[model samples]
Target chain A: MDILLEMLEKDARLTPEQIAIMTQKDEGDIKAAIDSYESRGVILGYKALVNWDKTEREYISAIIELKVTPQRDRGFEKIAEKIYNYPEVKSLYLMSGAYDFQVILEGKTLREVAQFVASKLAPIDGVISTATHFVLKKYKDNGCVFKVPEKDERINSI
Target chain B: MTDYSKKLSKTAQSISPSGIRKFFDILDDMDDVTSLTVGQPDFATPWHIREAAIDALSAGKTYYTSNAGLTPLREEISKYVKRRFSLDYGKDEIITTVGGSEAIDLAMRALIDPGDEVIIPVPSFVCYGPIARLAGGVPVYVDLDEKDGFTLTPEKLERAITPKTKLLVLPFPNNPTGSVMRLPELEKIADIIEKKDIFVLSDEIYAELTYKGRHVSIASLDGMRERTIIASGFSKAYAMTGWRLGYTLAPREISVQMLKIHQYAIMCAPTASQYAGIEALCAGDEDIEYMKAEYDRRRLYIVNCLRSAGFECYEPLGAFYVFPNISKYGLDSESFCSRLLYENKVAIVPGTAFGSCGEGFARISYAYSVKHISSAVEKLADFANKIKNERKL
Candidate 1:
């Protein structure tokens, strides 16, 4: 198992020294390894799995399914790029199953997300049609559980 | 008034209570305490393993299993031991127990005669000495050298042996110290034991968690297989400690005796857990890898933090603990731990909690979230610096 990557994946806040103890490796070695991973694009970036809903921050998220007409020699790549180029797009994936492309985006409100789909996404060349499904709530996100279950409040006895 | 002292057996009265328990009393009252004191993993049992147990329970597998535990579970254990460590034990030679604790107890009770000395390496697991004493055996403490990464030397092992020494308890991927015996180290010990008539009780509970290459079981060494009884289980590896599922593997003669004790006492390990154990052994390899990778990260972080705290920390290879020498601060293990707990609100186990040899050290566990460990390490460093500066005046 790659210990350094695992630690960063769970909580990127871990220092090199902390990672050294976890992997039984030296701090310098861990730092160097992390640097190497970073340079090689293995570790692209680190970001918090934020629960923005907890705060009063108003935002709406949606998963827009797009059925695109493949451009000659480009396939979905050409249209995927066009749709994903928008600043509102959070994630873009060429998915199997019912949708050829699943574009996840965030906007200030439902109206904003819908406006982006109608104005920005639908009008793109080779883009056949778009179906916007507003996400009402997220129970989980990116393998992290958003809603923490009620825990036993009693003291955790040793 | 009833004489409570008389009600308990002599051995029970003689055995000292765990040193870690008193700290718990202090901890319970304190709010916002960051503890690196627990020995168990912070990770939940993986979804599939839990699902398997749930399936078993829902299917009405609540009855007691056979005396040797569920046959399928035993077979899985047998296969796992052979596959992972290359130690051969037939399904008939394995007995599923409540946990590694039960297997250790069973081994001691089945082997120890009154006055028979059990050579236990000190500054390791706390249970070995007390359990051996309860079985009416004298515990011969062999203090391991921190300079050797707490690996038991042949000379020390030879010196501890006496005519009365009946069993040698080899705790590798050890607790508290987190020392692991490499193949050559095990080979050297095997050479000594091969000549001696004493049997071996090899507790390898943390075998799978070893990051310094795969764990080399003493039983796998030449001429050591016949005399060794390996006690390990799913608790540490599979995060199944709450299930209370573990097993013991020995030669037929020893396993048969251990099974008899287990049958009479535990009847069987929880049937649902045995079902879960099979799943753990069969399909839980990926989960082990996942948790191990996570622990490896924490292990590095804790050791580095301890070293930065101005303590001499020997990097632990196998288990989740980092034992750091705190003698430089001029305070004993207990006092340092107590002060750290009371002042900094960060709790760690004093090394003396493991054994007297652990006096100059403290065992800090990394089986917590990285955030928790990071904060605790900062507090520990602050506490150490405070004490160091105070002494400078």
Candidate 2:
């Protein structure tokens, strides 16, 4: 299952016939493997790589760290729900250590974040305090690095 | 069947979208991503400028002024331009619009026709191409090389020109890539435009934000005055983005057309904003100097940090962004930005978002607080080290 999943991840566009040829299995087996992966929710959805910087809409990003007291029964889920409700709140996660929740948000400017905190997140009952940290740089994410690979450097080289 | 949906114009539909927003959307979906993706200033609209707006509101200056903008504001802009860039224009020649953005749109609309080619140097501000298209012009994107500090040299400019070319959009103290074309560079471009009879739409929004040397307007050059339209505003210089006030300086014939467009399209810029703009132009020189000094500090810091982290960064001469060559990562800009946001929680705009030439580069804006800039650099260095280690596997 792991090998099949790995192969599919590498080439999600691979046809059943093609997979069958590579794995020396029947088309039915390849189709079944794909079906099982989708059924198990391993294969999500495909997306186009959009070049957003050229678009009309201005891209504004910030990372906000929140310190909150977990409510009874609901605890972090309730806080997370409250934070995620705003359309501007693109992502939210309960984090360990000094900060309780880390939120990733997008808006037109810094004032947008301030407004979100003032109007939406701050009023929530369990929220004790919040510290908003705007994002300044991103080097890598989701197995993609922003640097080009050199020809001389092999994968094994440190 | 009755048509229920409003039809968007083909021009509107065909508008090339901004690439900066994509990674921003992704970063928005992640938790704790540190980002230097913005292209604006970190400082607040200076106290005096804000106070001027407030004072105007308090004094019941809420009523709309002339479509060309307040007389005092236009006069101030006239003086400011002359004082700053040594460009001469009457108050009537300038029309205050909503940010330098509106100025660009107006210039294109006032001049360009359908099928007319608008030559734009690439890896520039995101608005030029789309705005050119909206004005019924075909955007002819010319990729500027990193070797020339991402500037459009005489050869590049002359080569990009065709008989169909009507307008040339020069975005300097450029965005994405922090390149500035000084007087010498401007002279080379002016010489070409003189021979070609092409109109120049110079976006000098970052005119006052230059770190080293002074900004020279193409209009200031010989024979270029009649053909050059200067687009600038108080947004970057005065940290007045929310105010949405800007102006253009052109020949009276062009200004007349631009005023007609402004009168119909926007009616007038915000009333208080015009008043604040007056204050920014007249009294905000000190504030501009202060902000530029701070930005210079952050700029140097980021450049050094990127260099130390094994990235090759062309020393940015103007603007607050540092475009670092990230080709060593073996990933494209999108993948690079996504991975950076997801794994290390550091977000920077991939250079490809600017244009095709921006591939294998990332634009990190230094228009942030020194503290944020330092911390982001630290986090980025860590991410670079991690990638270096991971490639070993």
Best by the TM-score measure? 1
Off by over 4 Å in 2: A1-158, B1-6
Model 2: CAPRI class: incorrect
Q: True contacts preserved, each candidate?
A: 0.50, 0.00
Question: DockQ numbers for every candidate?
Answer: 0.41, 0.01
User: What is the lDDT, from 0 to 100, of the residue B195 in candidate 1?
Assistant: 88
Root-mean-square deviation of Cα positions for candidate 1 versus the true structure, in angstroms = 3.1
Tens-digit lDDT string for candidate 1 (A11-93): 78877766666566777999899999999999999998888899899988999999888899988888888877888999999
| Per-residue lDDT of model 2, residues B333-368, tens digit only | 878877887877887888888888899998888876
Residues B185-246, candidate 1: write the lDDT tens digits.
Answer: 88889998988888899999999999859999999988888898888988999998889988
| Runs off by more than 4 Å, candidate 1 | A1-45, A72-78, A149-158
